[model samples]
Every structure is written in C-alpha cells, then in structure tokens.
Target: MGALALVSAVGLAVDDRILVGVPIWAKPFKFSVSFVAYSLSLAWMLSLLPRGRRAGWWAGTVIAVASAVEMALITLQVVRGTQSHFNRATPFDDTVFQIMGGTVVVLWLGALVVSLLLLRARILDRAMAWTVRLSSLIALAGAAVGFLMVRPTPEQLATDDSPIVGAHGVGVPDGGPSMPVTGWATTGGDLRVAHFFGMHALQLLPLVLLVLAALAARSVRHPRFPLLARLADERVRLRLALTASAVYAAVFVLLTWQALRGQALSAPDGATLAGAGAIVLLGAAATTLSLRTPLP
Candidate 1:
C-alpha cells in the first residue's frame, strides 16, 4: 500500500495541471506520501503488541481502504478540474464531498479502536506501552482537527458563493500567501500546522524511544561509553518518554490554540512567544529531572 501511494504521489507530482490557483495534482500527491508514511509507522508500532498481528491486519485493512477511497476521490476531482473538499457547488460534487468526509470519519474511528486495543493490552515494555498509548491519542486529536475544517466558519459562509463547509486558513481566506511546498498559510492561521504535528506523533515518539533503547543496548556492551548508562535504564527511559509525550501534547495544544485565535505561525505576538517559551522551559525541566532521578 505504501509503495502504491508513493507511486501515485510521484505520478501526480510529474503531471502538468493546475486548479484553483495551485497545482491540482499537488493535493493528492501530498496526501499519498503522507498516507504512505503514516501507514508504515502505524504498522511498525502495532507490531509491538502481543497477538497484535491479526488486529493490526484488520485495522490496517480498514485504514488502507478508507485512505485509498479518499485519495481516489481527490484524484478524480483533480481529473475533473473541480475542488474535492468543502465543495457543494453541485449535487454530484456535494455527494463526493460527503463520501470523502464519511470515509475520513471511518478512518478516524478505526484508529481510535486500535489505540484502545493497545491501551488495554498488558505489554512488557512499559516505555513502549506508554509511547503507543500517548502517540495514538495525540494522533486522534490531530484527526479531530479535521472536524474544524469540515464545519464552515461564519466568515466562510458570508463570503464564499458556494455552500461553504470549512476552510484551512483563519483570519484570511484560503490560498493566500502560503508557505513554499506544503502551502500552509504563512500570513494567517493554518490548522494544518497543528494537524501535521499531531498526526506524526506516532512516528516521532516511538522513534525517539527506539533510539534510546539502541543507545542503552550499546552502553551495556561498551562500558567506556561517555554517557552515563543509568540514564538509559528502563524506568528512566519510561520517565523520559512520558515527559517527551507531555511536551509534544503541549505543542499540539498551543498550535491549535493559536490557529483558533487567528494567529499566523510565522507572526506570533508577544503573548504567543511567552506562552511557547514557558512550555519549552517546562519541557526542558521535566526532561532534566527525569534524567537525573535514580530508579528505585
């Protein structure tokens, strides 16, 4: 599935087409690559659970189908030279939009179920268990952000000619002064920033833990290693993972808050700066304390 998505992304990237002031192919291209990465990460994490292979297969199947459907609809729209999301321009378009929305909801629910399963299971590695639980929850929160995009803001309803459902940008309309490749809003609040960060937690948390595990393994075999091995103990690593997850969650919340308040990512004011600084300091302190404390 990942390979297929990658191929689709490459194909779309090479295609010469434009729609609504941006490359129409770029939407599916980006989504394809994201889906590939997401699917691979999810599969790897699910592998950690006992008797999870079957469960993973079921969950992965559902997600893959839903994601493929979504990409197909978006790509179809691109081929037709029309908008895929929040477009109720016509009855047919509205139906397609509804299908896409429904498919995404299913995908989100499937993910939630997998997360619950992981949480309920009694895994041996405490740090990995916690990492899976926290990352899944964070990813779900990110998925929930899509709801905000689905519900039309008052500004969108008043301004757009079509029956507006939702938008990506806040303060300014969508498609205004976006960042380079990702096209996230630079001059206005873009919910995608939060969504992107939140969804990738699954990959980030586990990857960090894996690196710690590797370092710990290396230190055990090689006593001359400079870094203290005590910090690499399972308990300390668990504490560190928990602290990191908390910090990750804080950042997600801050981004969501900033977007809701119509603040641009690149143009955070004094309050935003102060709030972000405080969070960073707290994260640093927690990490330092976790590293210093001796395991009982």
Candidate 2:
C-alpha cells in the first residue's frame, strides 16, 4: 500500500489527465494513502487479541487484499483515463464499480468481526481495550456514511437512462468547486466529509488515548500527591474514553445530517451552526460531567 501510494504520487505529478475536476491519479493516490493508514491501524488492533488471533489475522489479511484490489482497480481506471466511482459509461466500468463496492463491504464486515473479537479479547489496559473496541465500532458507523452516495441523485432519477447513478455532492455537481487537495465539495453538501471524518476514528481515538497516556507518564514524585497520576487513572481514563466516543458519534451524526440537508461543511447556515454549537456545548458538558461522575 505504501508503494502504491508512492507510485500514485508519481502519477499525480506526471499524469495531467483531469477527471472529476482533479488529476486522473488523484483519487487512487488518496485511496492508497488512506488504505496504508487504515490497514496499519486495523492490523495493530488485531495484534492486541489474545484470543481469535488466527481468525483475526485471516480477516485482516482478507481486508488488506480487498483494499489492495480496490486501489488497483482505481489505478487501472486512471490508466484508462476515466472516472472510477459513479461512472457507468461502459459495461466494464460498471463491473469495476460493482467489484470495488463489494471490496468496501468486505472491509466493513471484516472490521465488524475484528471489533467483536476485540470485545472478547483481554487487554491489560481496560481503558485502551474499550478505546480499541469502541473506536472500531464508531469507524463502522463512519464507513456507513458512504452509502449515502450510492443512491441515485434526483437528477439521475429523473433520467431513466442516466449513465451516472449517484454523486458525492448533494446540491451541486461532483466536479464543482472543491477543497484543494481533498476534492471535497466546497459549494454544496458533501457526504465524503462525514465519511472521511468517521472512518478516521479508528486511528484518531487511539491516538488521543496515547497522547493522554504520554502526559500521564511524568507522574509527580511528591510523597502525598500525584498531579499527573489522575491522567493515568483507569476510572478517569475510562470515563474520558466513553465521553469522547459519545461526542464523536454525535458529531458524526450531526455531519451526516448537515450533508443530507445540502449544507456545506465550510459554509454552514444558522441551523447548521446551531447544531454544531449544541454538539460542542454538549461535548464539553459531558466531559466535565464524566470527570465528576464515578464510573461503575
């Protein structure tokens, strides 16, 4: 996957063919980079299993293979100088789309299995155990946000013989004004915003915990008091984890809702801002409350 990312980078630099308002290699490049991170995170999570090691290993392997194949197909389409997603101009293109769709499903189901296994496996740090388990589940919800793009848009529906079925942009065409490198819609609601945000929880949540742990490592040496020890407290850590995950889930839902309503992430209306403010207010309140309330 890393090699693919490097190759895609070269393609991005040299290949000038533009598709979907971006370089032909841009999609595959992004996909390759994402798969590298995603595959590594899942592989690490699977390694934590004291149980289901074999099953988890095989599942991870299958996921890696599926992701690789999906990336390969995207690259192949780039070589053919055509779009990959939502492109049904030809029969082979449609088949490739279907195959990539199946790969996504496979990856999601494999993660589901690994998450279930993690819930049953024993990890030394109770907080980290929960973080790994719940993050995977949260990522599951995030990955699901992509389904919103698979359905035919109203324009597509209006035309019975439309070659393109759906689009990532809600109120605008896919190739319109987009964020610089991400290619996410800037002019209209984009489902990929939530989808990308949600999918990254698998890595980000664990990273947050690690950062907290690092802060906790320099515990106070005072005889009677330990200032940093609370950062490492199992109960405190668990409370923070649960609170953070809840907030993450809420934000994911809010993003999904905002996109569904044809709202851009960069330019939110009053309603969108209110929803976001509510999430921020609630998250802060919940974090404070979690610290105050004792965990059972």
Candidate 3:
C-alpha cells in the first residue's frame, strides 16, 4: 500500500497541471519519493490491527478501497500526461478526488475512534487502550484541520468558465469567481498555505501518537519499570522528539520555500504563517502531553 501511494503521489507532484499553471519536471519525482515514504508508514500501521475484529477489518477495507481509487485517479493523470490536479478538467473529477480523500480520512477516523472506544470498554490492554486514545485524538485533530482546508464551498469550485459548457463551447467567459477566498478569512495564497499545513497534519499527528504507543507498550512489559518508568523512558521520548521535530521542520521549510517561490506572500500570508504555526504547536503539545502522561 505504501509503495503504491508513493507512486501516486510522485505522479501528482510531477504533473505540471496540478501546480496551477507552473510546470516543473522534477517536482513529480520529489513527490513520488516523499509520498512513497509516507504511504509505507501508513500501510505499516494498518497492518498491525488484530485480525479478529470485524469492525477493524471493515475499516481497513474501506481505507484500502478509498486509497485504491485515489491512486488510480492520480495514476491516470500521470499516465495520460493530463492535468487532473484539483479536478482541473471537470467538476466531477475534482469531486471524486475529494470524495475519495474524505472517505479515506473518515474510515481511518472511524477505526481510530472505535479502537479508543473499545479500549475504554476494557476490551483492550492498558498499552493498547492508551495507544488508541492518543491515536484517535490525533486523527480527530487532523480530520478537523483537513475539513477546514478542503471544505466544499462556492469558492473552491468558483470558475470563470463553465467547466462543462466550456469544453463544448456553449458557456460564457468570466462566469463566476474562480477559487474564491471567502470560505476562509484570508487571501488565496494564505489559504493555500493553511491548507497545505493542515492536510499534512494527517501524517505528523499519527506518527507521534503511534510512536508513543510503541514505547509505552515496551515499558508495560518490563517488570521493573512502572508508570513513571514509562514517562522516564528516554528511548520513546527521543524517538518522538526526533520524528516530530524533523517532520515539522521539513514541512515548515518546504512551505516557506513554496510560498516564497510563488511570491504569493501578502497580508494574509501572515495569517497563513500563523495557521501553520498553530498546527505545529498543536502537534508538539499533543506529543508532549502524551509522553508526559504515564501509562495507566
């Protein structure tokens, strides 16, 4: 699953049409590698669920189906050498992307939520319970941020030309607003920045939570170390710190580069920066809190 996702992401990056008029050959390659790494990590996680839980299996299936659709759509774009990014071709295309994306997110959210609920029900071990709860928190936060970023609105589909009619040459020019900034209280570029950071939160939040879960599990198995022992567990702390910090730093740098390169920074740019900063701080806080709280 990771390998496939990586391939799709890379296909997305390299495609010139996705970048709103700018074309870069190497961009796709970069996306390809990055996406592969991220997807593999996610795949590794989905593989860890117990086989006995019917709900978990179903959730995994849903996620798999959604992911497959996403990959196929993106792959088609890459293979056809067409620009399907953001549904540039047709409204349905973009809608499909959103639906698939949302489905994947929702399924994962459901799984995480269910896991936590089960843990609370005492159907899971201490370490497992803590892991699911923390994971659900992160997943919920990510979903909230993502919904904000891609919330369906008039602005997102605002178009000067009727996408359907224009293709057949039966529509007026300058039909309506194209990608309006009204959905969010900021400029287009700023919103873009906010969206970028928010969407990626899907990755960072889970990574931290899962890593913490792994550490706490190890501590629980050790007879000498108890609750505080888990808290003082340097291995987990170091891993969490390094993973979160590295990912955040890299994303921050890339976002800055993208913004600067596009020269899209304006008054709202400050707002974008603030949004991204908030996300970073939120992730950091969540990780810190989870680590600080000893396993029960």
Candidate 4:
C-alpha cells in the first residue's frame, strides 16, 4: 500500500498541473504520506497485540484495501481535473465521492474491530497494552472528525449553488486564506488541527512510554537520573502512560471544541486559555493521584 502511494505521489508530482487553488499533485502527495504513516503505525500496533494475529491481519487487510480505494479515487479525480471531495458537480463525480465515503466508513469499522480485539487481550507489557488501547481510541476519535468535513456547515448550504455538503474551514468557506503547506485555515477554525493530532496519537502515546522506559532502564545502571528514572516497574510505567493519555485526550477534545467555536488555532481568546489551564490542572491532579495510588 505504501509503495503504491509512493508511486502515485511521484507520478502526480511529475504531472505538475494546478487544481482548484493548489497543485493537482498535492492531494495525492498528501494522501500518500498519510497512507504510509497510517499503514506503518497500524502494522506496528497490531504486532504488539497478543493472540488474534489472524484476525488482526484480516482487519489490517480490510483497512489497507479500503484506504487504497480512497487514494485511487482521489488520484483519479485529480487526473480528471476536478475536486475529489464534497464534489457532486456531475453524476459520475457524485458516484465516485459516495464510493470514497463508503470506503472510509469501512476502514473506520475495521479499525474499531481491531481496537476491540486489542482491548480484550492481555499483552506482555501492561504499559504497552494501555498505550495501544488508548492510542486506538484516540485515533478513532480523530477519524470521527472527518464527519465534520463531510457534512456541510450552515454557511456552506446557504452559499454553495450545488446540493453537495462539504467544507473544511469553519466560519469561512473552504479555499480561503490557509496556512502554508498544510493549507489549514489561518483566519477561521480548521478541524484538521484536532484531526491531525488525534490521528497520530497511536504513534505519539507509545513513543512517550518507550522514551520513559528507555530512560528508566538507563537510570538503573547510572542511578543519578531524575525522579521518573526510578519508574522501572511495569505498573509505574502503566500509570504514567495512563496519566499522559488522559492529558492527551483532553487536548484533543479541547482542539475540537475550539474549532467548532469557529476560532482559529492561532487566535485563542482569554476564555480558551482559561479552559486550557483548567484541563492542565485536572490532568496534573490525575497524574499525581495515579502516582500515589497503590496497584492491586
């Protein structure tokens, strides 16, 4: 899947035509990178699960095929010199869009099944298990953000000539002023911020625990490291992962809230700041309690 995406990206880049406001190749290029990332992350996560390897493989296969179908449709639309998403400009385009949407739903359902399997099984390391479970849930939450983009905002319905419902930017129409490269909104709310953060939680949460585990291992030999260096026990590491996961989930929710309110990522008001502070305080309290409590 990753290889196919890479090939498609290279092909698109060489084409070098502009579509809508950006390069025609940009959509495939971005999707390729995302597909590679998601594929690698899912593969690594499934490898960590105990038992159900066959089931995991089936689920992973479904996800890969569905994602490839989505990428293929997007690339096909790009080649046709038309919009891939929220585009019902013609009957054929509408059919393609529906197919892509259905593929995404299949991918999401496959992920949910794998997550359920991971949650029910016992892995070798408690910390790693918690990380897998938490990351799966977070990633799923991130995928849910796509629905916001799929459904048209009230502004879009009132403004767009077509019956198609789609808009990426909140409080402003899509394709307005956007951030460089990512093209996320710079003047209004962009749900992609939360979506991006949420999608990578699978990689990020495990990475945090892996780093902490490495540090703790090193401290055992050196003995002069910081307080967290002493957290060599599986239970201690699990607690830490849980605490960090809680904080991470809170930030994801906060970003979604901020975007829904039509506030740009760069322009948070005092109230937003206050809300962030509260989330931090609550996370800190939870972490402290986790550290103090004894495991059964």
**Among these predicted structures, which one has the highest lDDT?**
2
Lowest summed lDDT across 10 adjacent residues in model 4 is found at 225-234
Of the two candidates 3 and 4, the one with more favorable TM-score, higher being better, is: 4
- Candidate 3 on 1-296: residue-level lDDT in tens? 44654554564465545332233222344334544544454454444545435665565566556555655565555565544433445665666556656765765565564445444444233433334344444444433433433333343347464232111001211112223321111222323353345335446555655666565666677757665355446554544544464445445444544343322433335655776677677778766765565433
What is the C-alpha lDDT profile of model 1 across 1-296, one tens digit per residue?
45545655675668667665577777877787788778888887677778666876788789889998998898788879888999888999999999999999999988987888788878898988999899999999998998888767777667757565678887767778878788888888889889989999988988988888988888888878746585568899899899989999999999998988888888898888988999999999998888888567
lDDT of 4: 0.84
lDDT of 2 by residue, 226-252 (tens): 445676577877778877887888888
lDDT of each: 0.84, 0.86, 0.46, 0.84
Which candidate number maximizes TM-score? 2
- Return the TM-score for each candidate structure: 0.93, 0.95, 0.48, 0.91
Q: Compared to the true structure, candidate 4 yields what TM-score?
A: 0.91
Which has the higher TM-score value, candidate number 2 or candidate number 3? 2
Pairs clashing within candidate 3: 2-40, 6-36, 10-32, 13-28, 14-28, 160-175
The collision pairs in model 2 are: none
lDDT string for model 4 (1-296, tens) is 56666766686668777765567777777778877888888999888777898999999999999998998898788878889989887889999999999998999999998899899879888888888899999999999898888887786667756746787778977777777788778789999899889988988898999898987788788787556554776777888899899889989998999998888888898878988999889888877776666466
Question: In candidate 2, how many clashes are counted?
Answer: 0
